[model samples]
Each structure stands twice: as C-alpha cells, then as structure tokens.
Target: MYDEKRACPRVVFHAEARLAGADQFFDGSMEDLSRRGIFVATAQELAVNDVVRITVLNTPILDLEAKVVRCTDRGIGLQFDGALYN
Candidate 1:
C-alpha cells in the first residue's frame, strides 16, 4: 500500500489565531504549518472561506493572513495568501 503524504508542510506549535472581520478569537495549537497554509484547532466555529489573521506565540513579528478552505468539528484548514512563512 502506498502511503499518501500531505501536500503542504506543517509546523507544530501553540499559537493565537483570529478571524478577520469577526470580533472573536481563539487559542489554537498548530498541528501542521507551511508557507502555503496551516492547520489549527480551536473551540470556535469557523466557516469555510473565512479570512483570518494568525500570530504565533513569540513569533508575532510575522503577521500571517490566510483564508479558511476547510473546517472540521475540531479544527480548520487555512491557505495563505502568498509566502506567509520564510
């Protein structure tokens, strides 16, 4: 059997992510992150196509803006606008 790998790279860290245009924010733990996108889990309900800004703890210098591509009961999948990570 061939094992399928993720199309995007993922980073493991605790971060704070907020939805743009929404007054709500969530404390999330990044499951996997890449320059292209990131996966995070939070208690809030995020709809698909929702634009958001993410700031990783201790790494606030890099402001990441992304759009929600998918959302599950536990987490959300985001796609970066451009080169979000260097």
Candidate 2:
C-alpha cells in the first residue's frame, strides 16, 4: 500500500515543463499537481534543490517557480515556492 504524504490534494495529469534559466525543456507526463508541489514524470537530468520555472500547459498553473526536492530515473519531485490558484 502507498501512503499519501502530501499536505494538499493532487490531480493526476500530463503536462509540459520548461526549465527556467536554462535552454532545456521536455514533456512531463504523469504529473501530479497540487498547491504545495508537483511530481513530473520525465527522464530529464536534474539535481536536487535546483530552482526552475514550471509551466503546466492546459492547466491553471503556469510560470511557477519550484525547487527540485527529489530526482530519480523516472522523474522529479518539485516543491513550489508559493500558492497556485488562478
């Protein structure tokens, strides 16, 4: 069984993520969106604690500054800087 350790509810959706301040981008599928953070399923090479702009296309969240908290071969987990609502 998987335990939910999230503070906010998350919605499962696939979206594109653009790395801010870098000339790199990729399609982030199997994304879990929430007010606190998001997990994007991508093989993009990234390090922990790296701040990047996350633009969730086809969703309300866009141009959001987030820090990479977790990075694995499957994807990355980002903790957003602020609230996401629009």
Candidate 3:
C-alpha cells in the first residue's frame, strides 16, 4: 500500500467549479478541499504544472489560483499558489 503523506487533510466537499487555463476554460465539480489544495472532478484534460484559475460558484463566489499537481482518468488534483482561504 502507498503511504499517505500530506501536511493537510482533505475534506469531502462538492460544489460547482470552473477552471480557466491559459487558453482553455471549462466547468467542473469540486470533489474535496483542504487548506493547501483541492480536487476537482473534471473531464477536461489539463497537463501537470498547468496554472489555472478556480472559481467556486457559491453564494460568496470563492475565487482562487492553483496549479495542476496530479491527474487521473476521473479528475485532477490542484495545489493552491498561496493560502487563499483558511
């Protein structure tokens, strides 16, 4: 089994999310979130290390900037540039 090595723990969260890359933009669903990063379930393909703008479509409309760290057949993992939310 693989060891889970993370500074922060992810929380189970679902929300409407939008991601904008350099020239591509698409809508996805936010699966989970933590202080340092978030997991977005998007069919849209994004390369690792790609910088993207993330907008959480909620009543307050949370906006954040993140980089693609991991990618899978189901979704993508993103790491925030800085501490946007606490």
Candidate number of the best TM-score:
3
Enumerate residue pairs that collide in model 1: 10-32, 10-33, 11-32, 11-33
Q: What would the TM-score be for candidate 3 when compared with the true structure?
A: 0.87
Q: Rate the local accuracy (lDDT) of all candidates.
A: 0.74, 0.77, 0.88
- The TM-score obtained by model 1 is 0.73
Query: 1 or 3, which is superior by TM-score?
Result: 3
Q: Please give the ranking of all candidate structures by TM-score, highest first, separated by commas.
A: 3, 1, 2
Over 45-76, each residue of candidate 3 has an lDDT whose tens digit, in order, gives 99999999988887497779999999999899
lDDT of 1 at 77: 86
The ten-residue window of minimal lDDT in model 2 covers 13-22
Q: Point out where model 1 deviates above 4 Å.
A: 1-21
Candidate 2 segments whose C-alpha is farther than 4 A from its true place: 1-5, 21-23, 58-61
How would you encode candidate 1's per-residue C-alpha lDDT over 1-86 as one tens digit per residue? 95647665556655665444367666677767676888888766788988888776666476678888989888888898986646
- After superposition, candidate 3 runs with Cα above 4 Å error: 1-5
Candidate 2, residue 56: CA error in Å?
2.7
Query: How many clashing pairs in candidate 3?
Result: 0
| Distance from true location, Cα of 46 in model 2, Å | 1.0
